[model samples]
Target: FLTAPTMDDKIKREILPAAVNYYQKRRLVHRLNPQPVTEIAYYTAGGGCLTSSEAVLRPKAEIQRLRETFADGSELYLNFSDKPWVIGGRQIEPLGFYASGPGFEAETGRKDGLWFDWYGDADGCFLNARNYDWLMEPKGTAAMGRGPEGAEPQFANRGDAVVKRGPLATDTAVAVMREADGSRRIRFFPQKQMGFVSIDLAASGFEPAEVVALDAEGNPVAGSLDGVERGSGTLTIRHRDPRVWSFRLTPGKGRTGR
Candidate 1:
């Protein structure tokens, strides 16, 4: 079980996975307005190098569709009439705490990694709109993903193979990123010319992936490059937010550096 405080009682404690499950089970009778919603503005302060920007999203048809599909799961954005939120905004304290049995985990995973260490453990938590439009309420107020109107909506397992030929001639490294919910993930595979090719992100100012050489059957071939002619290198990208990601890459021989 977890403990959390609300506006009424910053010291109040709540139950856990049961708290989360109760809402999920009661979702059948709950629903938000069927009207369209909009994201007039959004803000974020410097929580870190990653999430420190302001973004104004005009809900496109695709974004709207995504929201509608996940309505059941309270994953959609909700209007916080009195609260002012920024992109990197965090509550002064948790709103409430909930408890769960052994089968409770977050959609992101165990939350026990170097990256999440400073984020805290078993503290307070809250449920708010995803895109952060105070006037734009979600279809449902449950704390889970429902459908396309839900947070993760379909949560569909998509598997596809991509083949491309471009500046990235050789293969390098590969990785698969799985969310805690055990649904969607992004795969990174090394390309011949480009160091790393991500099935998740496209080209950006972010660092290119560290490309390793690969053999004939697409197996990683680890070796060192001595001269500019060998044509080998590395790249890494760190995330600040969903929209902003960092990047770095190796310039081929005689090429201008980024």
Candidate 2:
């Protein structure tokens, strides 16, 4: 969370000068939209630096002093809309937060490193020195990836779908659903990249005796499926580029489907 502007504000005063010099040296523009850049920053208290007219260059030594002065005991708060707010035909929303220095900690008890809070609603993802993970509490689903020092920063979710990229190269997307007819489906999207995605279907409220994979156009794609603890199942999608894919899980033989 953020507070109103403070009185001991030398550091905040330096922002204007640094930004003016930085932008004048090199003009910046929106990468995806290709529009003339106007806004530099947006905050709760005020819209950020509007123009570069009064910009000045500060000495490196002075800048370093300010950096050290403001490094400790600082909290940055950001507020974003839960749904998309479109301007100029682009969807902009608060998507991620990155933290550094010695202030934050992971649930697993790690310290003094990078931690990320991703997502906007009940469904979102997170990455830190401790681990890379995703969770959707309302749906009772979660997933995690293992990387060296737990710095893997590639995962996202929207609603029931989870997207991830593993060590090889391929990307995978999965969504679990329960149909009106009391059957269940796990939708999978596999990209051409070289990697594998492991999806857990336990939390979506279905347990499977067998699973089958199919392409977007209703063609079967070769893959492997196996059951996990608690009668749930894991789908390992590997080395395929079917534009849209899904797996329909069959309830345990002679058991009612969820």
Candidate 3:
């Protein structure tokens, strides 16, 4: 629990609000009871020096096998031993980021993965990805929020809530959660200051002949869909509002039969 800052005015005014918001978001994740929650995962590599084990060139593949760690984004820890007698240096490829897939990457590697040029002060660092804020802090961060339960859940419940989700391609990270009621809770921070996003919904069984943006309280917000003029297939949403948006995708025009 985060208490309001009672000290410096700067701390009280600036930091407390953010803390409160984060706490509220965390509570929201808890309230989505019986749903599968994803917590930030940390993967460790580089114990080969002690055991003299084989070097691992593909830590990403190892992390993949440990999918149980986190369903969404996670942190990869690459440890480097500074021992004077260690041979060659424990090396591993942090595969959290790849051009073809979604994964984590160390923030320090702004343009590429962490590499040793042999002149640096030290080796190994706990990395926060460039998208760490989007992946961990935000209430809807896929890595920290609840996701649809998995197939053959070990403790499956008869009344657990369920949701559907689809992958999206965007310049930056976006969080999406499809509810049991066919509504969508989206967390998209437009890379551009203006509000303009094209969603692949509103077509077929996706829901609603038309779509509208709603605030968390279910009040309609000022927004528009390209479908009004363009057609149904690629519905583009233009809303200049908050980063998090909720939409009701019911009253669909998709296939109902067969």
Candidate 4:
């Protein structure tokens, strides 16, 4: 019997490289026409790349004739350039900037998860995944490169909530939230004494509310809520020990019990 080719093999040998070449050619044409370049690239194993000009150029009736593909996992490479780019019709800035080099490879379908190996200068490669509907970094890696200032990556929809590290927040602190209930949760596991860590709760559909803190055992703790703004709230979790904490925000006054 013969073993079938894996998704990683298909991606390395065909999918990703094909995408790079397709975009490179499309970019070349856009350079001459000088139209706004689409910054986002979507890839799936079954449906190679969903956003393609070829489909757009076809007639409405013939558009469905275009091939469709899907993948077990999806990967989007953002912030290749320092210009504004649009994805799904929304303008977004590049998450990071890196120079081109050799040995650039990305493979998925691994039991551990996706693997991206590349040789380049990723000085500004750090990004906040919460800005988008679906974005995640490789596990066991920092938002920035491996450094003292790096943060632990966050996964989507964990425990009915999505947690995101603040832009300047380190791995020691985290922003936990459950969007459906419109509440905010913060926890601290600091290495040394720190003043406070401000977490952005806008992306998780957070709203201003009567904030309360809870200890590891779910008991109320003393804390405060500040810097409340439209579609955003900043919670200051101050600590000096490696303890777990959480905050809950009631959506409106006299409305209790989340």
Each model's RMSD to truth, in Å?
20.0, 18.3, 16.7, 17.0
TM-score of predicted structure 4: 0.30
lDDT of 4 by residue, 1-258 (tens): 012223344344433233332323222222223233223334332324445654465444332212111131222333322233443543333232122222121211111221111111111011121212121233323432433322443322121222222222322223343435444444332223233444444433334466565666867754333222232355445554333345555566544222
Q: Scored by Cα lDDT, where does model 2 land?
A: 0.30
- Tens digits of per-residue lDDT for model 3 on 51-87? 1122244443232211111233322233221211111
Q: How many backbone clashes does candidate 4 have?
A: 7
Could you arrange the candidates by lDDT from highest to lowest? 4, 2, 3, 1
**What is the Å distance of residue 137 in model 3 from its true position?**
14
Off by over 4 Å in 2: 1-171, 190-195, 199-202, 219-244, 253-258
Off by over 4 Å in 4: 1-73, 76-171, 179-182, 190-195, 201-204, 222-234, 241-244, 253-258
Runs off by more than 4 Å, candidate 3: 1-167, 190-195, 201-208, 222-232, 242-244, 251-258
* TM-scores of the candidates in the order shown: 0.18, 0.31, 0.34, 0.30
Worst 10 residues of 2 by lDDT: 60-69
lDDT of 1 at 33: 34
1-258 per-residue lDDT for model 2 (tens digits): 122223233333443223222221111111112222233333221223212232234322221100000224322222232222333333233332222223221111111222222111112112111121332121112221133333433323322222331111113333344445454555432222223445444422345666566566756555433222232255454434444355555667665433
Clash-forming residue pairs, model 3: 204-254, 205-254, 208-250, 208-252
Please report the candidate that would top TM-score against the real structure.
Answer: 3
**Local distance difference test values of all predictions, in order:** 0.22, 0.30, 0.30, 0.32
User: In candidate 3, where is summed lDDT lowest over 10 consecutive residues?
Assistant: 116-125
Instruction: Candidate 2: give its CA RMSD in angstroms.
Output: 18.3
lDDT of 1 at 249: 33
Measured by TM-score, how close is model 1 to the native structure?
0.18
